[model samples]
Target: MEGKTVFVDGALPGESVLMQYSSVRGKFDEGYVKEVLSRSADRVKPPCEFFEICGGCSLQHMSSEAQIEFKQSILKEHFEHFGNVQPETWLEPLQLDTLGYRKKARLGIRFVTKKDSCLVGFREKRSNFLAEIESCAVLMPKVSELIVPLRNLIGSMDAKQSTPQIELAAGDDALAFVVRHMEPLSEQDKEKWLNFAEENDIHLYFQPKGPDTVHKVWPNDNNDRLHYQLPDFDVELAFHPMDFTQVNTSVNRAMVSLAIDLLELNGEERVLDLFCGLGNFTIPLAKKSKAVIGVEGVDSMVKRGYENAKRNNLENVDFYQADLQQDFSEKEWAKEGFDKILIDPPRSGALDVVQYLPKFGASRVVYVSCNPSTLARDAGVLKEQGYRLVKAGVMDMFPHTAHVESIAVFERNN
Candidate 1:
């Protein structure tokens, strides 16, 4: 090993492997484990048949417990290197069922004439081509089992070549699939999908163009909405098929409970929820707090959030639309004061909104993040503003993948 750095894929920290270089750059080189001479104790046989070829999951080769520890280490390293700080206390990691937990995904579709079959699943590892898979184990069982059937269904259709992808979304009570078709479907093809939905007891939707063109195709009485309930708070959230919702429902429920506990509301405090999508956390926070104000970037989502609040009969919760990345300090909602703040911003982190923390005079802030580097960066800003990271921990929202979902509690310094 010379002074040059080699980036290896499919290699663990304590494994000895025969690697083959894939790319060599001026500063660093990239390689993959061609053969493992010595494997780590944490290595395990992946459960999915398509693990090696499909790019859907990366850490399926490692044990579940080991995966959590590795993610914790990644969080710690990000804090030390990017934020220049650490939490006063580390909370226990929140974990749940690892398999069949994904409730949402976008799968690629390709008709391979050579094989005289259709491939319906994730893309190939490190490639744009669709992976050849009959079924998937990571997706919710209802959706996973449909992979082969879907392939056959598409193969029978004349517009099979026009189909590019399938978007899946499952709520507590409903399963929905949005088939993205490049061309208009013939009546025969439409009947095929309708029968498929009827036989499988699943909802079918069609997307002829952009996301705005998505419409329900099956069950002429399509008034039913997709929803998930938080039994702890007696809150039910209804969402559009294209709306953003957590893939793992159990972990989401646990995460909301943990956030509420960290807030320690006494039914007399005012809470601020930023980047609140469909009022997932806002409605629950409203159950314990005196009042909750939710802010989001999208006008449609904000409108839906208000509808969710009304549907839940939660009069104390209000929603407003604002671009958090830009200056919104002049807005009425931004001028309001609160006792607690909760932010579940996108992967870019909440640096723009975190800067205005002092104005709210909130004593406690709960930050939920999907990306650790950005979280660490925003944490540093809060630290500079006299907020100490009280406790932080990771959530296994995405069990088999490298994505990290974490939450942190920051209390203002006296």
Candidate 2:
């Protein structure tokens, strides 16, 4: 091997290992660890038996603290490389329970005629084939225990081959399983699922088509929403099973608190929450601010935001629907200035929304990002608009993985 860069999987820094090349590129090469001649001190035995094959948790071999440090370094590198700037002070990484924290996930479903069983888990590493797994260490305990039973339930059904996915959405008290089937389930098969739901005391839903076709089958309770509480603000936010939410409940609570603390809201200030889905942060902001306006891209989420605001008995919060990727400067809500702003955008980041910050005249901005690369790029844009990167830190949202979830604060330069 020459001096060209090589991207190795299953290999750690300060370790020597035998590698098998998977692919070759003009700039860099890619490979995996065939055998480790030397091991890093940070490497540890993966707890899950399926860690070797299952794609669910990638960094299980690394210590939890080491994983967070690695993510922090990645964020730091992104800021220096893309933004050409760094925060004046780095905040300590926010952490919580690393395992048994994932509350929502879309598990792949496949029936193997050879094994005479349905495989229910994530895909195999670097492959599209589903991994044969009985339990997941990262998923919530209640959902993890259902894997074997769910496999049996699907294997015994006539529509096993037609069921391609099973999505789990768990709240503080309720757990839901949304089975996506390509064919109609036989009445007997439906009865089995209903009995299982009743026995497990969980909600069950069927999705024969798209997201719109998803409907509950058990309990017949008109209440389809799942709620999680922010005890810090005495606020509870209700969301649909398919809506976007943080997977780690405990980490989410801590992350929301951290974001609000960074904003430094006063009782007299008005706050703007961008990409606010279902009033997760908006409601909490309203509790500390004079008024809060939440803007989201989806209409359903806006309605859900209103629903959550009313559910929590908060009248100072308002929800609005608008495409955050496009300009809405002339919109009535945009005309009203905000004293502080909080943004929690998807992995794509919020370049379009960040560009409009100067127009809003917010003195302080708190940005929560899942992608450090995009966040760094947006940081550059904010710098050009007369904002200084004040402080930043990473949060261990998706532990045992390379995904980086971080928060940054920007203050307008005087």
Q: How well does each candidate superpose onto the true structure, as a TM-score?
A: 0.98, 0.99
Per-candidate total of colliding backbone pairs: 0, 0
lDDT of 1 by residue, 287-366 (tens): 99999999999998999999899999989999999999889999999998999999999999999888989889999999
lDDT for each of the candidates? 0.92, 0.92
Name the runs in model 2 displaced over 4 angstroms.
none
lDDT by residue (231-268, candidate 2, tens digit) is 99998889888988889999899999999999987799
Candidate 1 global TM-score: 0.98
Checking candidate 1 for backbone clashes, the offending pairs are none
Q: What is the lDDT for 64 in model 1?
A: 96
- On the 0 to 100 scale, the lDDT of residue 347 in model 2 is 84
